[model samples]
Target: MLSTKEHADVFRELLRKGDRLYLVPVPGHSSALPEQLAAIAKNISADLELVETYADVFAALEVAVEGEKKRAIVLCGSLYLIGHFLSSINN
Candidate 1:
């Protein structure tokens, strides 16, 4: 929805997390999001884990939440992305 790269900073702030995980989409699927979002995570700290699949994201979140570290998981995506993860869980 945006043509400029600088505007990503706003989302970057909103998306900041204790330890962020980026679910990078496959090539040609707005692939720029990986780098853009990762930059946001790096702006907060030196740690950023970029995983390529929904399962990896769920595993990471499970570990984080189970650790009792009070981490907030923010999922920002279209309904299709949400459905993909949901389907993964049901199978």
Candidate 2:
């Protein structure tokens, strides 16, 4: 979806305002991956922007919620991002 201008714009808008923005990308791509998926794949852009580990992500969330009456952290992506997030915490 990031390859499409409309979808990409929507995604950008969704992350524009927040205490912190993190993008946890899938680690690697296979040849079986479609071209659009491959085009948007990278760890450095999403890679470097993401917290060093998922624990850092949760820690960021705890800090983020400190000032708000109501707040939530929205995590998006496939099982990959969630798996990465969970595995980091489990380890």
Quick one: best TM-score, which candidate? 1
* Clash pairs, model 2 backbone: 43-47
| Model 1, CA-based lDDT | 0.48
Model 1 misses residue 61 by how many Å?
2.8
* Candidate 1 structure quality by residue, lDDT tens digits, 1-91: 1223453554555543344554443322333355554555566545445323333346545655665666566655434445556787899
Note the Cα lDDT for every prediction shown. 0.48, 0.42
| Candidate 2 Cα misplacement greater than 4 A, ranges | 1-21, 29-69
Pairs with steric clashes in candidate 1: none
Scanning candidate 1 in windows of ten residues, the lowest lDDT window is: 23-32
TM-score for all predictions? Answer: 0.47, 0.37
> Where does the lowest 10-residue lDDT sum fall in candidate 2?
29-38
- Which candidate achieves the best lDDT against the true structure? 1
